[model samples]
Target chain A: MEKNKKNKLSIVSLVKKYLPATVALVPLTIIPAPAYAGLITIAVSSTGALNFGSLDAGGTGGTVVISPAGARTQTGSVVLLSGAGLESAGLLSISGSTGVLIDVAMTNPAFAITGPGAPMNVGGFNIDGGGSSVSLTLPTNPATFPLGATLTVAAGQTAGVYFGTYTVMANYQ
Target chain B: MKNTKKGSDIGKALLMGTALVSLSSYQAEAATGTGLMSAIILTPIDVTSTQVLHFGSMSVTTAVGTITVVPNGTGGTRNAGTGSVTEIAGAGLESEGALQITAATGLVMNVALTAGPFTVDDPGAGLPMTVDTFMGQAVPAAFPFTTSIVGPATNVIVPVGATLNVPAGQEAAVAGITPATFTGSYTVDVNYM
Candidate 1:
């Protein structure tokens, strides 16, 4: 009977020794994992560039518009000329959880394209068919869309090729 | 021993509940894309002189004479002023200077001229002539004029004319070989109004 009591005591002591470590691990396992939204990623197509094509900014300046559909038009003294590097809308490919509502936006609503001549203003940024935001279509893991904007050319805009960079962002809604 | 085990289990359950409550919140994720924008701008407002002003051949006697070339259409009308001067008809085509200004349609531009009583001299030892009263057949009928580039046309042509003054007993030929030939230059300035 004395030996049995000693064994019980030793077992109790072992449980006591390990109790602190067990308690420390309990919180970690019991804490529910937070639900996470799918990560959204956006990229411009390799062959895509927002191009206004060839234009003649006559004696009086005007604006050139490139539609999301890649159609080019002009107003005022701006003349549209067809040649190499013809007008095209920028193509954006988005990848994420399908059916996730997304909000797309231009980091800079208005910016400038500069070259040998005076800088031209680029504004009125829009997505394909028009709108600042878009919803990812269902079942389409990687969705593609077009982006377009208006270019304000100064009167007597000097002759040369103008270049600039613009940024866009996509976020889970 | 039963009492001690029950108390430890109760304490662990309370801590677990607290941890679950603290960890249940949501956050948003975002991504960005960069795009290259480009454009090509062509030349604007190109001005060129298509034709030069010419004064047909003329003969002068002992009296001072003058030749007035008026800007008509593409050509000019030459009139001999009061003196012993005669125009040698069929010698050459006398035309007014033509300046072709290319720009955007419906654009209005201010036209200016650097008028000169320019001296016209020959290669030989002959009397020199003077050209003055530089004029352009433009709107407002005077210097410092303005022209509108009409639609369906990207350019406009302005005709320029002038007057030439000859001295008495002007030489008829240079080195007594070729007919006396004179040449000079003038200026035309244009700007956006």
Candidate 2:
């Protein structure tokens, strides 16, 4: 009977030793963690459209390229026009938590621009300053970047205004 | 036993909470934006042959000779290489081959001619004469030409010329009673450079 009483006392001592740590965990589990509030919020918007100005695709077709710096160039039989407006690269505005590294990508790298005539292909998407990835600087909620691409004009491409849509995605790295 | 069970429940709750937080964070950390792409296409380049190249009538003697037609607009000159060959001069008898190319003004283009030593055959006579050394004369420029400037007023014209080889003692058509006429063709290709 004396031995049985000793075992019960030891059990009580074991619970006392571990009970404080277990009690500490209960509040942490029930109160809800505040780390959720620290999650970064990311948003992307377009500031301007990517424009390749007037061009002539001669007997043999050619390609027109727009650089991230908003400069336009061409190859093959494509001719650049001296119209009133200047060609420009696409502009994107990204807003996110400061000091976070962000990745930039084109959901559709290659697509076609349609118009009255045949469709012209657009590809070779690029970004300036940083390629494919960028970091948000301190004190700036929204960071802006430039994007560019190449347009393929077919031989005897019908004369008209061509239009296409592209998607740019931003994610925290 | 009761304390141990309570600790286990707390651990399970912590794991579930952590999972929920991860899901919420992922949903808010990514976004997509759309941008417009645009281009304006102009008219395409066009080319056509305005005039056909013709080498005039000639008579061969006892020696081998050649006839050369110069490519100089419509009034191109024809010359006999050897003294033995005689060129029959007549109105509308011979002229240089001409091509009219049209494209955007100031656009540069390349002109190519495909003519190897080809035979000009007269069906009446079994003997055939070979024509070779084809050349092109581009106005505002010389032969072996590279670029032609497109026009605000007139399209660029390229006149072609070649040499015709006549064998010694060549036979006439229809048992030497009627004149023999020979004919063959060459290709001209033009493209924007």
Candidate 3:
């Protein structure tokens, strides 16, 4: 049958001449680091002046302990990145860094606000001792722009507010 | 020739194994990375706190002093931690309040029986209300600090809408209470779990 139609036209011209060099080795995905979606600006002081929607509902534990302006133990800290070549990290379940300075003796309680009782240092100007783990280090190659170091006072885990001022909170997944 | 050179050596090993699986699909799949970073930056912290303890009976009383937990017993005299308790980490801890002492002649001469959380809510069912704002400061005395229990200070961890501390060892002391010099807000709502 015409020699099997000339071998199916010589295997369709050898798959169209090596198929564009095998589709140019099938690469050219040009994402270099695509998956971008950023917006980080956690900077607070004394109830942190409010952001994210301006919350203030009776505000006590959920968070809200503004005491900015020179601060004292209402300290602060934030350092987590994620947006460039991607490699940020995880585990930041926080609960307001405890600054406990007790004395009611219903039982035994006694541990007075250590770490960085936040004395103003997050975005208002570096000063973190609020340490419990918020150090992702964000400066690998030329990337450092994913922010998050709050203190609007939600009081729980122990990362409790510090120095005396706060702002920026209400984050989700 | 030899079966056409063994079918051209199996077509050049299937064309270099499809060009190395299309060049490793453009790399970066270290089996999944939740560590995505291309522009996430935030570095500004000098000190933070969480305390974190797992054991039990821990004391810290520098002066406003008085800690008397009594689970099995053996707990008192405290000046605990100190300047941020080494800056706590991971688990979390640090909280201690209620210590009113003043003596200019207003009242509350020296009342500070540690162990705290709450600060100004409920003040019961666990303990948290210890008041004494030192009417007028001129000499009062007794006011050093370093307290931090946050975690296993006997039985920490207070959550659920939160508000319950000063329960664990239970013991009150306001005795003659009359010393004033900035005595009122000794706040301590612990646990950052």
Top candidate when judged by TM-score against the true structure: 2
lDDT of 1: 0.73
lDDT of 1 by residue, B59-122 (tens): 7677787887788665877776547567777867677888899865664677787666577787
Q: lDDT per residue, candidate 1, A1-173, as tens digits?
A: 99999757755655555456555433434444445533444333323889998777876888988889898888987767654447899888766667767777777778899999778899998787655555555247677888888999888788889999888777767
Q: Rate the local accuracy (lDDT) of all candidates.
A: 0.73, 0.71, 0.24
Candidate 2 regions with alpha-carbon error over 4 angstroms = A1-103, A107-111, A114-116, A121-156, A160-165, B1-42, B81-83, B124-126, B133-144, B147-151, B172-177
Tell how far residue B88 is off in model 2, in angstroms: 1.0
2 or 3, greater by TM-score? 2
TM-score of every prediction relative to native: 0.53, 0.58, 0.18
Look at candidate 1 and tell me the lDDT of residue B69: 79
Q: Identify the CAPRI category of the predicted complex in candidate 2.
A: acceptable
By TM-score, the candidates rank as 2, 1, 3
Candidate 1 chain A: minimum summed lDDT over ten consecutive residues — where?
A: A37-46
Per-residue C-alpha lDDT of model 3 across residues B39-115, encoded as one tens digit per residue: 11111111122221111232322223222211111111122323211222332222322222211121111222234
Residue ranges of candidate 1 with Cα displaced over 4 Å:
A1-34, A37-47, A135-139, B1-28, B50-90, B93-193
Interface C-alpha root-mean-square deviation of candidate 3: 16.4
Interface RMSD of 2: 7.8
Consecutive 10-residue window with the lowest summed lDDT within model 1 chain B: B13-22
DockQ of 2: 0.28
